[model samples]
Target: MADINIQRKKSSPSPWLLILLVLLGLAAVGYYVFRADSDQPVTTAPAVPSPEPAPDSTTGAETAPRPTNDPAVADMATEEPGGSPDELAAFAASDASAPNYGRRGLEMLMASLRPLADRDDLRDATVSEKRDDLTSATSRLQEQGTSLRPGYVAAANLIKAMQQKAYPALEADAGELVNRANALSGRTNTAQEQQQVRDFLSRAAEIVRALNQPAQ
Candidate 1:
């Protein structure tokens, strides 16, 4: 045997072993990154709720109930008085009793007519005075038609005719006006309403008759 001793070089890792170690190291690193990410708290946002619906305006459903039975309350509900001119006239002309509202309206019209007819100088009456009388009578008569009931349409026409005429001309039409008033009386349910209409006719007649009497 030669004196040279066979010395074994220190063994190096095989290429396959190095590759396996590198793959293991990479896998450990990936696992650690995944575990770190997983350890943190998962924050999810809370869900938002939808809004509620609004109420209606026109019906006033949310408000307290109104008192329909009370007269004062009923009056408060409407801005204008009830009854129509035609209906009021028809009612007055009918055998059925005129509603309190219409009956009262007749009384008011008669009141205004009385002063105009009873005037000593009706034919010679100033146009201003005649206009005032016209205004008062027409306003009251018009009110009869306001509350949704038929109003004194017939009587309103008579009033309108009177308003269109001169004092002397109105005096000439008084007889015809009287006829209209009497016609209104025939439609009334109550003696009082009829009598009121008659009184108005009588005053209209007086106005006409006085016009013929030559200034006293």
Candidate 2:
């Protein structure tokens, strides 16, 4: 009998070893993907825009925001001018103790005299009409029960001089109006009062200019 040589089959790779290799490969791939994600920059939400400031009602302009605690701003707010011409006139003619009495009285007097001062004819019917207004203003001031300030009295006296056709006196003493106004302004506690006095002086200066104009 011929002796048959049996060839031994080579053993296949273990299933558990193959499974372990696949798991290791999957873990490495997952770790690389996670690392790629971690390397990117984080995103943030966009910022919201601020709202605009409101406009000023009187001037029709936009006003900038001011600090509430700022002393200058506080003073400006506190000293803001109040009332209309009619109201100021009433206050001026009411009483000596009235708020802004002297200032308002002077303002009213200056306002009444402005039109008459600008006229070319002192004896025109328009002069009488304007003088009537001045008379009415002075009458109210005189009717007030309280004693008047020297500044207000001086203004009234000047108006009286105009009523009496004392042109020379008016010309010579017109500067006294501004001088008294300046003195009163210096005594003012607020910018608003000082400003009112300044306005009175400006109007008084215009009257002086009209008085000084060359005769036609």
Candidate 3:
């Protein structure tokens, strides 16, 4: 046992190890924050790409549509038509709304037929009144077309037949157009619409004649 005193060994963490652990923790926290910000938001809706706007092509135009109650057609009249772009759009709409020639013809005549149907002199067996009526209808249809409304084509057809042969044939044509006009008139149309319907009806006799007219 000599006077040899061994100093007790003390265990302590190395400074370098402590510093390295602190740096690793700081790096992990920074990585976590960045990852959170970069992730896309969770959404229930399917993602879709936004649409791009159409380019303006209209730069010149001379005419436009007339103002009317049909909200669908209102813009057709006033759109500052710069060129054919607007015109094309309007034309497409018109063609779609217009009545088909033979398919959707009216089932039968309404208020518009009053003038023709009630006339005792013309409504009877005499073919003369029918011819006269057909002529008048033809003129009116021409007027409508020249005025820029092409809706009177059926009426015009009736008128052409009067110029051809008479009697049984004219009567047959008259029936077709008159029935068509009457059917239109019977509908719940507005005053203006009713007027158009009436105009259509009055021209029935003439449309018959037009239909019979020789192919030209």
Candidate 4:
């Protein structure tokens, strides 16, 4: 009986098995890194805030937007000199003893006649239409009554002559009107009143000059 001691040889792993194990380990590590990245929160840029409006220098408040190019807005921004014709006429028609009564009355006269004298359609207007316009303007003037300065009477008379077609005396009437207006010059108490009277006279002179032209 021979005692045969058979020793089992220790087998090493195959190269393919070693490669598979290495690949599995690498795959696990890659999956954990991918999951860690996926779990992380996303970063983004911060939002920018709007700029504040500039404060007004005088009021220390935010200024309003600038006005557009609308004509009505322009008209509102810059008021008419003195006031509108309707406003002047209203002032003239008020109590006779008001402080600005005489000045406003004369201003109303100037304002009323300015459109008539400058009317482009005047030449084309019928005789009756011309008389009607003159009559209306004269009536507006007369509404001021004693509030109007003394000189307006002659001017009104001249306009009346035009309405009546009394052309011969118009020249004399116009001359008298000019003389009266000149006589009243610089007689007003205030510089403003004086300017108003002067403006009225200038406008009256323009009307007279237009009337003096040969009938077209």
Best TM-score goes to which candidate? 4
The CA lDDT at 52 in model 4 is 75
- lDDT, residue 115, model 1: 36
Off by over 4 Å in 4: 1-3, 14-97, 119-166, 190-216
What are the clashing pairs of model 2? none
Q: Residues 137-178, candidate 4, lDDT per residue (tens digit)?
A: 334443433334443544444343452343453566555555
Query: What RMSD does model 2 have?
Result: 13.8
Indicate the worst ten consecutive residues by lDDT in candidate 1: 147-156
Estimate candidate 3's RMSD in Å: 19.3
Clashes of each: 23, 0, 23, 0
Lowest summed lDDT window (length 10), candidate 4: 138-147
Cand. 3 TM to true fold: 0.21
Residue-wise lDDT of candidate 3 within 1-216, one digit each (tens)?
A: 679889999989999999999999999999999999889687698889898755444544535544588733532332223223222223323322244311112212111222332344334433345534433433333222232122233333333233233344456555555455544533323555544544453354234323324433
Score each candidate by Cα lDDT: 0.47, 0.51, 0.40, 0.51
Runs of candidate 3 exceeding 4 Å displacement: 14-117, 127-129, 132-216
lDDT of 2 by residue, 1-216 (tens): 999999999999999999999999999999999999999999998989887655555556646754597643543343224333444444443435446555454555445454444455555554455444543434444344433345443553454345345365455455555355445532334657555554554445454444444433
Ranked candidates (TM-score, high to low): 4, 1, 2, 3
Q: With candidate 4 superimposed using the best TM-score fit, by how many Å does residue 4's alpha carbon deviate from the native?
A: 2.6
lDDT of 1 by residue, 1-216 (tens): 669889999998799998999999999999999999999999999989887656665543767664587633532343144233333343344443445534554443434443333445543444335534433444444343333112233333444334344344554455556455545533445677565554543444344343334443
For model 3, the run of ten residues with the poorest summed lDDT:
101-110
Query: Which residue segments of model 2 deviate by more than 4 Å?
Result: 1-120, 143-190
